[model samples]
Target: MDASFDALLDEAAGAPVDGWDFSWLDGRATEQRPSWGYQRLLGERLSAATAALDLQTGGGEVLAGAGPKNFPPTLAATEGWPPNAARATRLLHPLGAALVTHQQGTQLPFCDGAFDLVTSRHPIAVQWPEIARVLTPGGSYFAQHVGGRSNVELTAYFLGPFEVGDSREPEVESAQARAAGLEIVQCRNERLRLEFFDVGAVVWFLRKVVWAVPDFTVERYRERLRELHDHIAREGAFVSTTSRTLIEARKPAP
Candidate 1:
């Protein structure tokens, strides 16, 4: 939540233009079923939850997937970017939802014990205590994120270490969640393959999908683009990237 993060968010939000609409990514991933390893891991528990909170509601795929909310538990969508908020509105409102833009820093605006389930897909992974503070007793938090140094080898092989930047370390994230009084309910992790047509698509995706552009400038972006092109020509038509860590933890019952 600093200027660096703001810059990354600004660049990171540039996905729709890059062939990354829900249907493109989610639709295809849905068919793979294997790519859905994240959802499959948490599906049953999430489906049964009443109130739900989706933090960092990027494209709100999880929000859309949460299904018809008849069972009631104050479902809320918390997002960051202004455009994403609008998009989430379009995606979630029809399902009877109006999302709130979450205020950054360490404070979450909701009252303590306000939700029965919390979910996020590679959200910044900050504000664990805030998440815990808002969860109702016996609540659960489900998240799928880029684990720390999680996919370094693939990244370095393709574009070098400096080009790969993300903030998801299982130890750090889970530790914070546990410190906030949540139990390690379940964890599922695997090296997965998400394909792009070529390195241009891969570069674009690293900028958007993985949020790993590492805060460069116009000139630097060009340099990185060239580097990615060179690597692709040398390696092959596609690049393989790996991300791990999908976890569900539970808040202790009061």
Candidate 2:
């Protein structure tokens, strides 16, 4: 039998959201993967690098998934959120990677030209200058960034109509990288499908990805959640779009 709305809500709300893992939502929601196979590509790059750094490495999930055997001689990751940082430390230390607790928007705590490769998956914000500063000559930065207007439909649903911003645009990011003295080697963007099988999935998602609905709360958004629940009941699922960008930049050799 299908679970009740309240039951689903309680289950999702109580589910632990530690780390970057989304296994809890496995059967409740689905999102399409990019064609570039970021984790695989990351593993390949890590294999060739002598020293590597992963910025905003949420819970070190992706880094660890890239295979510790593929890790460079020197591997390090930075995460800002305390809970995530603690979780990442536990997961990454055993893999021989050091975890640095770092807040976003601050300067990276690494020496200049310290790493041959830098990578991230869906970093909240890219510190272009810091990235350039930390990369050795001829080093590269590879990452799959969350593009602008990502999940705008889902965000707009709870907040009402809003103006879309140009933040996270690939062209804008490429320009910023160039201004930071890195040459853009590759840039690609894709819009993918996302679906929520139930309101519980939506609740868990908003709770996990707090930025989606900055002020989300069951008491605050209960009415809207109920409306969405009905809509999904009639429509089978609540559909949305997600944007992603694959970007690669290289520092000059000279």
Candidate of highest TM-score: 2
lDDT of 1 by residue, 131-207 (tens): 88888989988887666664355356445556433446566667777887889886666665654433335434555
Q: Which segments of model 1 are wrong by more than 4 Å?
A: 1-36, 40-43, 69-73, 150-167, 217-219
| Tens-place lDDT digits, model 2, residues 1-254 | 34587887788789888789998889889999999899999999999999999999999999999979899999999999999999999999999999998999999999999999999999988999999999999999999999989889999999989988786899999999999999999999999999999999999999988988999998899879888988999999999999999999999999
Clash count list over all predictions: 3, 0
TM-score of 2: 0.98
Note the residue pairs that clash in candidate 1.
51-73, 148-168, 148-169
Q: lDDT score of model 2? A: 0.94
Runs in model 2 lying further than 4 Å from the true structure: 1-3
lDDT of each: 0.62, 0.94
